[model samples]
Target chain A: MRHSDQDLRTLMRAAQGGDRAAYRAALAALADWLGGYFARRIAPAQVDDLVQETLLSVHRKRSSYDPDRPFFPWVAAIARYRWIDALRARARRPETSLEAEPPVASPEEPVLARLSLDQLIGHLPAPQARAITLTKVEGRSVAETARLTGQSESAVKVNVHRGLRKLAALVESE
Target chain B: MTERLDMMIDDLAAELAPQPAVRERDGRRAALAAALVTIALVIGLLGLRPQLVNGVADALVLVTTALFALLALAAGLSAIRMAQPAVGAPRGGALWLFVAMLLFPAIALVEHLVGRPADAQAQIGLMCLLNGVGASLFTAAVIVRHLRRGAPVLPEAAGLCTGLAAGAVGAVAITLECGGSSFAHLAFFHVGIVAAWALIGRLVLARLVRW
Candidate 1:
């Protein structure tokens, strides 16, 4: 069964109290979320290591985690930082390949895509940006994202529905 | 292709988690080393010569012990409070404690110098000077730990260095008053204590503080 935000909060408290079971459960749940988040940006072979690094960092800094905040966002922030660190490490490595695909979409694409999406997604609300990131960027199923995110499946579905419609409308207008 | 995007997201997720084994192994090693050091120091202190123990000629030891015990209790409480999620700026409190611990020994030295009776007081003063030197070394260890953790090192280091200098001066004063011409003992022991404290501080700081 999916745990609610309140449920995750309880688990966080238990983990802070040094409950191994609660820590394990929390790690297991966050791992999937983090896995999907990193899988998009790093090589398949490196993703596992990155996920492990993020999880370990989270565990080490667990005492710093505020129970009042939703767990997934905090986990997501950690994942984001790990992603940035990985990118920096990769940048420092000597480039051996004769040809390498540019690390990301052309800078122009980000500017255009973000700007186009911002007008639309920005208008929908914060929930829509979060929902789209989970569904589109992270590729979590609506039910799973809802469970991890502590939103009701119906609430998640609505956010996804509105987000996608807004994106489609923005693209159509352009 | 959409499949590529799916694969990429999956790959990134797996890359972010740290290896559980590495974390566990490092934590275990650190905890074990700290415990071992504590045990070794306690054993070594207990093995000191009877003369050295007997030479502590006044009630100063009792007073110093009481003072340190209270300080240690306060430090322990601060550590616990800093560990809480709600505590903002843990570094601030940690820094303050470091400074206080460093200055504590110097304060004791001043109190000993200013208050003790002139004749027997010289012996007491000498003992207090030695004790202050020991405490200064301990405080240096605490400061080094803070530095290793990537915390600000300047203020704590300043406090410790100042205390060490004050302790050396106190030792010299006691030696002069006691009609002891041996600057060697004062210089060697006082400076040696500071160096030892710095070394131990580096080791403990490296072990405990997360970089």
Candidate 2:
């Protein structure tokens, strides 16, 4: 979040030119950002997997990015396609539910999820993180968090439980 | 999680596949060039039918030839556009053909309404239509194979456009090669090929283009 969009663009362009460290940093930032982005829209349990796929999709589609254009949209385009693909895939097999939780990263995904609080906060699903950030981290009431996030109070409460459960699962896995 | 994400980033970088830059090739140019070359060869080999001039008045022959040529060109451009992963439907570009399409059917209907009973003449050798389709298919197949690499996001649209391009070539060849100018024959065989290609694009070829 400290880097300007211009800085991100420069980082991506360097990555395109085969700067490995720059590329890694850009992807790390993107993966972290995607965690926040997806947290709001989907269940907390689904966030990590989406982040990994979006990272790969961005890597695969890097060819399509025009450096002159804004960076996020290019990344967002890949994210959108992957999201749609995931939706179609989920639709084909709707028996899966959030409560069941997902298995850890698949072979196709890079193993991710060592979390420092900043990076952990970075990696949490958007809604869960937002719910946590508002109601727990910032000490807002559940109703105020719900009002800010446009979530029902029950949904807000559920997100807090689920977000905490996600952290606990990471600890249990560790 | 910090160390894991750090290691993952490093590993991802090490394994990262840097994609080659995308250069938007002119699919339209490739398709049209292929079509024009193939149609030229078809005409040279099979010869334009002598009956074409006598079957229709000079103005109508000129008009019909122009119409078929334009249709072929339009379809060629569309096929190329649709083949690109980024470009999807032909959108507004495909509407022009409907004018020619409607005119053919409307003329046939009005002729029948005016008491000229459907004048379907003797079935001439439709050998050229088939050959034209085959030849254009070969050319289109070669060019489209590369276009497919660009990633056909709308596989159905891409396939339809590719098929329509080939069909246009076939239609043009038939225009010059068929002896019968009967409204029924031109409508059924000439224009019908494009429709067939569209269906093939939607049903058959789309699957082949997918990643």
Identify the leading candidate in terms of TM-score.
2
Error of 2 at A24 (Å): 3.9
Poorly placed runs, candidate 1 (over 4 Å): A1-5, A9-49, A56-174, B1-67, B77-91, B104-205, B208-211
In model 1 chain B, where is the ten-residue run with the lowest total lDDT? B80-89
lDDT of each: 0.45, 0.61
| Tens-digit lDDT track of model 1 for B52-106 | 3456532433333333334333332333222222212233333353345445445
How far out, in Å, is residue B206 in model 1? 3.0
Give the distance in Å from residue A91's predicted Cα in candidate 2 to where it truly belongs. Answer: 2.8
TM-score of each: 0.34, 0.63
lDDT of 2 by residue, B1-211 (tens): 2465667677879875555444345455566677777777777877776765456454554566677677666656655544333312234344367345757767776887899867655255255445655665755574466455554444555576666666667777767766656666676556665656656655776777655
lDDT value, residue B1 of candidate 1? 19
Q: Pick the candidate with the highest DockQ.
A: 2
